[model samples]
Target: MTTPFRWDLVTPDRLGSMLDGALAPEVGYLTELCRCAGKVLARGGNGDLVFVGRSLDSMFDLLGGALEGTGHRLARLPLSFWRGYDYSRAHVLRAREILADLGITPASLARRARPVTFVDVVSSGSTFRSLFTLLHDWITEERETWPVIRRKLRFVGVTSESKTSPNTFRWQQHADWTLRLPAASVVNVSLDRPTWSYFADRQRKLTKSFGPRRWIDGPAEIDRDDKTRQALAEAVRLVELGRAREVRRMIARAMEGEPALAEAWLRTLRSRLS
Candidate 1:
């Protein structure tokens, strides 16, 4: 039997003309990012998984929807560990407190003998490295476990492709930095060249339009914006109905209306997705 259409399998190329003029530029970009990210997760993920980060919650939902028939079990650990922030004593204590509250004891993780993949978005990879260290210490000091607990761990990072040197092996660099794990254990779902450039341009524009802090903190603000919420909801509805063609048409029409933005969006998408 043929597999049914799922959002995880959707990519910018597949969206085709739907991304042309049918939806707003920002909406189209967000939809494409979520779809591409979902595709990456579905392709690279293995065994049982724990996904971390608040910004990724929506993308995880898309992934979960696509993974409906797959046997993988997924858990969300909503710990907000900022990449460049200093780790104060209070932060360490709070992390321990949260781990205790979540009942992530060594016994619980080891009970089923299933490997656990840790999923997150990576820039510098400091968050996952810190998490690995914290978990290692906890398993050693509190649970009094050794190599067995460590063996069942894997890390997956969803990141954008490099702009300066587009063909560089970015994942390997990330893997080298992640502690106590083989480079192979780190899986990256990097956005394709066009998508990554488009994203970087958007970030630069947002920063210039607002400020550096606004760019850094945009996800929260975008999430709370009513228009963004509605646009995302509409995109989800279209995917559920398998109306990808309609989405394409909508994007085409929207781009036609705003020729300047449409020109830039399509130009970038063409360079990458083509």
Candidate 2:
């Protein structure tokens, strides 16, 4: 199935009537998103940020808006995978094909210039685990260089903000597959609870969810109803904010405390954002 069409922020003028009375988005929603974006860049090791699903679409828009001319790679992978679900052979094959089309196959991962970091709003992290297991198994089946690909793959989970204590539950630490990658490959960024829940649970979206059931369908149909249009407007506004100089600086500032700030690549990216 074909990917859904998201509005192009570069030519908003072309969408004149669609945006004429569009919903006024909550402009103040940027703080949590921008903070998380900075950490996505800082901890992403200056690599491509691939949003794993629809939940983080707004964050992707925010970054894409601000990264307009910086040569930074930002993208979205629409699959909505879940752990502990059995898949039929046809479904698995189609999923693999989709991954290949996104240039996420073993060969591409091995030759990429920078790492590919997957970002998503996470709860139990079942989605991340499911996607990782598929890729790991596919790499082994293809006999690709695991050692080379391991370093180039990374994951960043956007979790609900919580105070840290030894007893605090951390999803990555409890997942067995995490041991397969380098310790630093799996990291996290937190957003306040209200905003986190809003994104993961209640946000309006323009496209149908691409779960396993929808894998073999025809091209996705975009919904142009009032809700979809309003969602589109909010998304468009996010990109505009990203293009602002002060907003870019704010996102860059969020990176100041990340440990990745020490790396030259991350340092260069921070400079570009600033």
Candidate 3:
């Protein structure tokens, strides 16, 4: 019997569309940047604070070279909300979740005495303000350990966010320097631009390696059972045509009764197939 499941990866395009509605054009630069760097940052990190407040496009360009320069050691924070929802609530909640996953709470930082850098695709100062406030309290409470960890606190934001008020005050007042998009250039394109670009990029690779586009348009709803199965079947067909090694490995893992692995593959299938 097919195992029960009801989740799918929201494409970067979908994420962009969702974000366009949630934040003003200015605040959503980070979201666009996230689409370009999300997969990479999720999979890689370099141990240096190199740039801040740069455009999403420029940030992506720099990600690889910076990693290479730093000997492939880096840390990244890919801020995201729930799938297809880019609300600030989702953003803040996701940020907290990532921090929790890293065990990098304010209180924890004081005790560890490790300088931590916050890196993202966009820096509006607003986003970092809330994040930094949380850190500040944690550092303040743990005065004894503050010195050990204080020097380690750094932030690098890509792209521009509204600089209104004290948004990212710490970066302005405290950070070494904030790298930002140069004036006269479009700092942030429409939120959906990067997402669509990433999808187009992936689609091009898949099309080149396999055959023509067959899914018609992306699925309207992935919540239903039939859609999920239909989606996976399409993915299996494409993977077969492309002989995608990783997809085959996942299919093998699923066949071996690795429920989590199976679910992940299924989710990816749903996303790619859609």
Task: Please report the candidate that would top lDDT against the real structure.
Answer: 2
lDDT of 2 by residue, 101-135 (tens): 77888889988888999999888889988889889
Give lDDT for model 2: 0.84
Candidate 1 structure quality by residue, lDDT tens digits, 219-253? 22223234443444444443442324443333233
Of 1 and 3, which scores higher on lDDT? Answer: 1
Candidate 1, residue 41: the lDDT equals 38
TM-score of 2: 0.94
Better of 1 and 3 by TM-score: 1
TM accuracy, model 1: 0.56
lDDT of candidate 1 vs native?
A: 0.49
Write down the lDDT that model 3 would get: 0.35
Q: Please give the RMSD to the true structure for each candidate, in Å.
A: 13.3, 1.7, 17.3
lDDT of each: 0.49, 0.84, 0.35
Q: Which regions of candidate 2 fall more than 4 Å away from where they truly are?
A: 10-16
